[model samples]
Target: MKQFPTHIVAVDGIVENEKNEILLVKHRDKEIWTIPGGQVEIGENLTDALIREIKEESGIDVTVNKLVCISSNTGTYEGYNGYGIVPTKVMLGFTCSFIGGELSVSDETSDSRWVSKERVLDYITNPNLIERFKAYLKFDGNIQYIEYITKPSYDLKLKIKI
Candidate 1:
């Protein structure tokens, strides 16, 4: 059997606008939309990485309200590096408040938009991301723990919503 790669730690911020819409970004290489975030660089704080990623991808500043969920993703997410598949990823989701900055795009992102919670699925399709959004909505004061695995793997671990 081949050895699986090491897990990558990432951070995503759920920014809610005054109108109650969530921010989503479209990567230049993919059509599917997703929340703004990126990998937490070595020696960088999680919150700092969240702020930096959001700003870099969506051109928006944010203040983290609280951590909403922690996702262990074993599914293959495409278009990040030259490699086609991403290894296991532990992503921390945070509920954030918009600080400032106009909506804009960077080389890493093609478009950015504010989407209503009810209509978010209209834009995003990745099962893991959809789970993250659902977890974000269901999040209470406590953090929710989730695991997203590719189908047919038959690895039934456990499921619990905060």
Candidate 2:
């Protein structure tokens, strides 16, 4: 049997404010706080998808600033339910400016808030989130990426020299 080729395109917006705080969505799936984003539709550009997902999920309108990160990873989510079965996603991350929107919850989100870099540490133990946010916070907003080739095992295809 031939292996199937399935690729899902996803976009995540790192919306930052003048105070350097980042907007994060408290997912209804788990207790993790992640950026607002979703799958990029067929024939749709990456930026357009990020814009749409942020609005839909977090009620936040965004103006994409830059491709801060390009992460390529293949991993199993173990018990992750939202995007199921054979899961392989290509996530395009962009830095964005918050234009205007009210804080609201969607089916996918439990809560949404603008958090300071300091607060991210308080939310540790949420899987690999600590490391992920550390990269974004430590840097001077200098776009980067963290690719996980095999999760569940915490394996990565690209290694960062720390």
TM-score for each predicted model, relative to the true structure = 0.84, 0.78
Q: What is the lDDT of residue 33 in candidate 1?
A: 89
- The parts of candidate 2 lying over 4 Å away from their true place are 1-4, 76-84, 124-132, 138-145, 160-162
- Give the runs in model 1 whose Cα sits over 4 Å from its true position: 1-5, 75-86, 151-157
Taking the tens digit of each residue's C-alpha lDDT, what string does model 2 give over 16-57?
877887888888876677878888888898888888899988
Put down candidate 1 lDDT per residue, 19-111, tens digits, no spaces: 899999999987668999999999999999999999999999999888888888676656444786667778899999987899999999989
Where does the lowest 10-residue lDDT sum fall in candidate 1? Answer: 150-159
Q: Which pairs clash (backbone N, Cα, C closer than 3 Å) in model 1?
A: none
Local error of candidate 2 at residue 63 (angstroms): 0.4
